[model samples]
Target: MRDAIKQLAESRSECTTRQTWYSALFSYNYPNSSETLRTVLDLLITARNEKTTQLQDTGLDPAVRARLQDEVSPLIHAHLPDPIVSEKGAIGIKAESVYQFYECDAGRAAVVFVSEILTAVTTELTHTGSIGYPLTTVLASAVGVHSRFLQASKKQVLDDLPI
Candidate 1:
């Protein structure tokens, strides 16, 4: 399941590029296909349901679970493209706040902040210095990767924008 989630994340990253390319094709082709749009919406709904179910089964602490869910839910809501197909073949995937969360310095900062908090909590819970140091290092590395991801996304958005 973890692998599946990781793959999904990776696929989503690649799909962003495909989306840009397809937007141009879509604008020229079938610009109004409610049926096709509906299929995408249905798939999103199914994915969300599965994720929710997985979260429920994880048995994480209620507070932690709530916080994670709260943080992720808005991103899901914001990023889920409206089924409306534009003339430019844009699927109306407008979620500037959510996009910014994955594309800006502030967003990277938030990830680092959360990672540090988690590291501290883990350190306190286990009282095992060995584990804490490695976890901290991993979290720090994640912050760097996330920052790079955001930078690339920002560049892509800028490239796609109309002058």
Candidate 2:
């Protein structure tokens, strides 16, 4: 039992561990990371399912699959309301606060601000300790990947419809 719990905590060699992530997010006791990490896990499982179902034609190689699972496929929340997908008010507020706090509006110095955020988030969320490890990883990179996946899933479902 102890070994299993330890493995579970530190597993997901690709993604960051829950203990580290949760502690970074709030603290070891905060519950939000439970959902966040599980969501990431579920997304990975769904990506595997995609290979068997909608994305079979693409035939991703092992490297691509590992990259997608480990780096690019985690969902992200946009600072502005993402009405097209789903509305997460709390995340939206948090994102907005981050953007303003860092002054993403600070055009010339935006690089520093963005870099700081990317470093913090990546350190906490990815096992690689670097952005998109193997390629070019960033906090927002997963959003692009997952958005495309959602779009592909929609297309696949529509194609199956008789209409």
Q: What is the Å distance of residue 29 in model 2 from its true position?
A: 11
TM per candidate: 0.27, 0.18
Q: Please give the range of 10 consecutive residues that has the lowest summed lDDT in model 2.
A: 83-92
Tens digits of lDDT, candidate 2, 51-116: 445334477777766655443233222211111111110010122222111111112222332333
lDDT of 1: 0.38
Residue pairs clashing, model 1: none
Give Cα-based local distance difference scores for all models: 0.38, 0.31
Per-prediction backbone clash count: 0, 2
The TM-score leader among the candidates is 1
